[model samples]
Target: MENSFLNRIKGKEFIFSTLLVAFVTVIGSFFRGIIDASNFAVLFLLAVVLSALWWGMASSVFTAFFGVLAFDFFLVPPYNSFSVSDLKYIYTFVGFIITGVIVSMVASRARRQAIETKQREARTAVLYRFSNEMAECETTPQVIGAVRKNVGELLGCSTAVFMPHKDGISDAGSDADFPLDTHEYAVAQWAFSNKKPAGSGTTTLSAAKAFYVPLETSLEAVGVLGIRTADGRVIFNTSEMELVTALANQSSVAIQRAVLTEKSREMELAKKTQALQAALLNSISHDLRTPLVSITGALSALSQDFEAVDAADRKELLQTAYDDSLHLNEIVGNILDMTRVESGNLKLNVRPCDLRDLIGASLTQLKDKLEGRMVAVDIPGDLLEVPVDFSLMMRVFINLIDNAAKYSPAGSEIYIGAKTEGNMAVMTVKDSGFGIPSGDLEHIFDKFFRAVKPRQVSGTGLGLSICRGIVEAHGGKIWARNNTESGAVFFIRLPLGDAGHGGRD
Candidate 1:
């Protein structure tokens, strides 16, 4: 609405400029009765200045021609016809047009500068916004998101960001662009590998459907930024092309920041890994030895004297040996789970299974751990069967429930529940334990991730990672977060046999 109003005002100004010049020329014609015909050119020259100042060069030209014709017809000898009686008067028209043209050219120069000034301001604004957006990005995907959004806005075109990979660019799909085909993607690959631009607007590979530019820092070409205009133009104007280059440069710097952040994270992770390795060595010497020593000592005591000990003592010793051996077996089971996940060697024995049966079987196995804890089970009465590896799924539930029992205070309630969400069977395990630390929430399911600070907890941190591996193998999702009231909630969502969302397909 405001734009139309401003345009209307400009239209009126141009019209008034034309009319004002015409009025001045008419007035000059009457005054020529007293003034010299050449002197009348001065009055029309004023009209030319007015028109040029308010409108375009073409309007000024019109004004100049109108003035000369009026002067020749009204003020020159034989004052009514275009056929001038005196040929010397023709010089007046020539001088008049020359003055008008000179003024018009001057006005055009000013207008050009004004337009350039506006464009510069606009470009500055775009750069400022681009910097601010890029500054907030902390990850590679976030940087790509910023580039996608900003490029779409600034360039008014389709855009895609392709990160570097072993073979070529990695295409994380974007809705903002129609994906390039094999030939076009090859152009992008060339741009990235060569650390130069290719495709539509560039000198190289002009036949490509989209323009591809390498997002390069001084260290390396991190990725490629590709764009295609909506107007089907094979090229951009000078300023536009410069803007795209600047965007690529800015994105390069942002991606460089992300790269630096990742390196810093890796360094920190390496440090943690060293500490964990030391911890693992300690655990091997302690955790593995303690149970083995118990089993060995009990067996030795029983074998050493047949009649020296009572039958009750013999039975107790055998039980202790059996229990320690079970403990050792649990530790070995965790090790095997880690091996299976890392080596991708887990083969599932999948079948349609009931959640209630799985939960019951898991709880039966965890009776020792849950002996002192208050347990709540809320499996929905009509829960659907899920396609799963039954034994692995049972282990997942056992680990989760055991983790809950281990972390929570003795006698605190552990809640295990299941319901339906969309086409998924949603199960949750909640414990009244100290919640996961905020920084460590995302890393909980990572293998060997202990809490930031050491704890009195006795087990290796492989339980949740095993659960993650098993659930993912079944095409399910698993995540944990602190509950609002207290403790933490671990959620498992698995598809109900291709009902929707993710499944075997």
Candidate 2:
């Protein structure tokens, strides 16, 4: 309420002091003889000072003019006109004008400094309010909404938040009337990925209408913040940018905290599950191993007497024992791998390997699942080598390919391609199969994320997630996207080993 009142006063044409100066000048002219001449000059100087302090240089000059005119007409020898009989009166008028001008000039300078000081204080107050609000925000959506509303009100602009995605940045809190354009999305993504500012008022892409700032934390960038003024002039100055950076930093910290809390909860749950798994393993190991040992002893006795018994019965017994052994091995391997991955104890032996050879090995391992599918290999012979844990990367590819084969029709085409783009080696595995549902796209790489819509498929739902873990540990990224034509495509990008320290091979 106090702010509103001050704003109203600031918007006025003249301040109270300016009006007071005019009032005193008029009354002083009327009561000329009663007022002492020398003292009246001091009063005129005070009026000029007040006018300048409240209403600026123009008001102070007008006050000085009126003071000189009043002194000459009412206080000189002539009572109602500008005629001055006494020559000493000339010095009085000259001295009065000089004093008023000097006082007004000084007052104007002081007023300007005071106004600037007040504006700085107001800006700081706004920043404080913004920081406090951002600290309370938990999720990305909440932060985006709060920031948009607050920034729009504070800076008087239409605000937006754009989050970086595979293709571009999607609007976080945008209305239909102000939808983000493609160019804006690209600029926003660039800013977000690089943790730099772009668009209006920045060195890069300053011709763009909107300003893009990266919502960067100490670790990494969360997203991009966009703000556009109604008048289209960039409203963000150096101080404003600093304030925005501070706000973004606070928001980043809050988001990081929320994510960490969620992960901690998940870890606790996993620990509990691990205890249950250990008990189950203990029970299964004892129960199943005893039966398997008895069956193997019976098979050995039967094999020794095979020549005297029926050949068909002996063959069925041997095949049954072998299949059970293979099934038991697979279950044990899966359990061990899960435990290693969950405990973060799966160390990778990183090395430079031919992507073509890696892809071929992965495909060979899953050849049974591929069945009648046409596996088209598009990797060039001269493709650059990638730095990776060869065995881990093979497992990642095999899992992705196996997943595609399971969801796709027998006769569908599966394309595996690799190439070098920028400083990364890009690989894509695509299948002409059922595309991922829109709702499941975001969680495709989450542990135990299965498509509920297609419940008929049998899976443990940990393939993609495990693949993501393996790729990320090797300083690479893995993500899934729906193909434009049909089916789903999983993309992997590894920094080229030959590039530089931060780049993957």
Candidate 3:
């Protein structure tokens, strides 16, 4: 139950004062015959002390007034009437009143100081609680929501948090009931972007309905916090502003920590992936090379004994051995290229080169595979030269051509074209083959990624990945897009070299 002001005044101290006054009156009445004038004075002084001890100065003054009245009524010479025949009784009453007033004055001053002290301690406790709650928040949204709720309770206001967004500022946890206006959002966005407080109590846009304080840390402003007092005025006093700023700083730190943690996780995952790729490369290289070496050695030995071997057997052995070597070489190359790319060790020797020459070299290298496939090349004489690493660029074209041949039906047309687009030299290798599945378009360049439908084709699924790495190393980009007219079109875009340099070769 609440202790009312009157109840506090009439508590134990008030009762004690009343009882003491009554006791003194009774004693004076009983000792009237035995007690001398000096005894009355002593009894009055005892009453004054009791009043000061039990009832504070004000109560003491009241008690002294009653005590004087009792002294005269029951112990004065006239015996229990208001009439005091002696003038000394007047002196005694006056003396008692003066003492009570002095005591009350001193006690009242002490009580005022004590009350002020208690209020200060209460405010300190509130600030401590606010700080503790803010420290426990982790993300920007969490911190904003917590600050809004706590500030609303602490300051007795409707609080909102406005975070910076691409369009403007959005309220952190606002519902339909607390819709934000466009001007308020714009104002909040301005405050956050500029790291300044505006609206209401602030100097900038003081007429604004709500107070906006920038949530800033050491690095930058994270967002803005807005508060509206119950009376519809902003309540961003100095202390309140300081508390809000502190909360905002803590929030910024939390956001920064979260971003750093996410980046750290990404780096760790990349490291583990690199380690796995290295192990796989080691295994593939070892397993594929052993049989390849043995088969090649057997071929050499048989060729030396050609006269002793049957003609048909020698031809079959030579052909089988040749095909096996090619397959093993392709697998080994894919593994090495993948490992290099994953380790970030692939280096490009970029120079201005003719796209026609690059395409021709790739075609020559894959001639045996493309023997039954129809190849069509369309290159203008005035086509711009592109800056690229000749050897790696050729390999990219070779991979694309070989992939096209493997997927295209026998005797299907394959198109190779070079053209210029804006500042880029564009080369497209298109084939009338089974189009890439729509779901696999994005992952086509990912290591070890292959479409399920293409499983029948022989490949380690690293060809496109290697092609991407090589093209990117030369400051170019390669991508696959399904041609509306026919099969998939693999487009390579390389920055055009200076006209005077022709093409880096």
Candidate 4:
């Protein structure tokens, strides 16, 4: 607002400088007898000085020229005439003109210096703001956005950042407002290659539509920043060009930092992937070998001493071989299920199946494992049939029951309950066993995760993880929680309607 008021005052001084000189001439005429021509000359000089202070060199010089004409026409001895009776008066006129011109020149130079200082301060402030915005950028695209926004606001022009890639320069999906044509691209390429500015308002390729500045860092040039006004011409003063170059340099540093950060993240991910593969290979080899060894040893003993062993001893050895074979089959099955789930190939054969029948089948399958456990079933008789993949869901119940039996003490009551809640069928398998650690509850369903408790229990830790995958693929949710009194409870919620949302092929 203050600048506008000063501009208005300067405009008035330029437009009315002649009027001021004329006013001084009238005063001189009024006091022609009282005031000598020498005193009148001082009054005209004061008018010229005022013009130089307010309106700059052009207006001040204009005032000085007209003041000379006014003095000769209205105040000189030969009033309103150019003819001078004495040639000595010509020296006085010459001296007056020189003095007026010198005063105007001095004042005009001072005013120009002040204006330049103010403009430099304003440009510095703008550069500070652009620097602050660049500091918050964390990626190449984000840096490009900040550049476009700041440069456009600074110069009232469209802007873009062209980055080098395998195929020369590309915008890298940044939707820049400034479009680069063939000529403009050539100009931008020259700027980037030479690490200098080109195109409009510059010495090189001055006829191009846009101006291009190289985004150079201490290391090397990263890209080119292109600028174009709406009229297809770029123009800037010294301060503005300096500001553009400063922004480009800051952005180049930021882009380099972002690129390095991305590469660091990728390296970290590669290290993690290597570690996970090693862990997987180790776990599979150990689990696969243990059950195979047990089954081989049991069968080898039975084959060598079938007649020598008593009837009861033969039955015990046969049972041991059967159990180990089942264990071996389970390990292979869990591994296959995990592979299918991880590869996104787990398709569901959805069908409406009764909760009681599913639970009964799972219990029957695990009859040997749950031999010493007391099973308590509390499902409502008229409970609605849940839409699910029958085999996948039966496996879910089997895993839950087997896990409970393995963890709990002998003869402990394992409760299985089911009921309808809203549009869902909620089933829970709970056991009176050592509850999961508070920290491990959230990670229990993760692949290869085993609890710290019950280290003696034997099996690969893929059962619960597979169960979770299968349940979720059937459009259901599964979770485990510690009971208020003791032990842990596993809950499964499945949609009771059509299986449209399930992972069906």
Which candidate should be chosen as best, given TM-score against the real structure?
4
User: lDDT per residue, candidate 4, 304-359, as tens digits?
Assistant: 98888888988887888888788888899889988987778888888878778889
Which residues of candidate 4, in runs, are more than 4 Å off? 1-55, 66-113, 180-187, 203-208, 304-325, 328-330, 337-432, 441-447, 459-483, 489-505
Off by over 4 Å in 1: 1-43, 50-98, 159-214, 219-228, 270-278, 300-316, 338-356, 363-390, 396-505
Tell me which of candidates 1 and 4 scores higher on TM-score: 4
Model 3 per-residue lDDT tens digits across residues 359-403: 989899989888977899988676356777788888899999888
lDDT of each residue in 286-354, candidate 1, tens digit only: 778988898999999988996898999999999999988987899889878877976798899988887
lDDT of each: 0.82, 0.74, 0.74, 0.82
lDDT of 4 at 66: 86
Give candidate 2's TM-score. 0.46
Q: Arrange candidates by TM-score, highest first: which order?
A: 4, 1, 3, 2
- Which candidate do you rate higher for TM-score, 1 or 3? 1
- Report the lDDT of model 2 for residue 439: 85
Q: Which residue ranges in model 2 land beyond 4 Å of their true spot?
A: 1-21, 36-38, 56-58, 65-94, 105-125, 138-142, 164-172, 175-179, 186-207, 214-223, 230-505
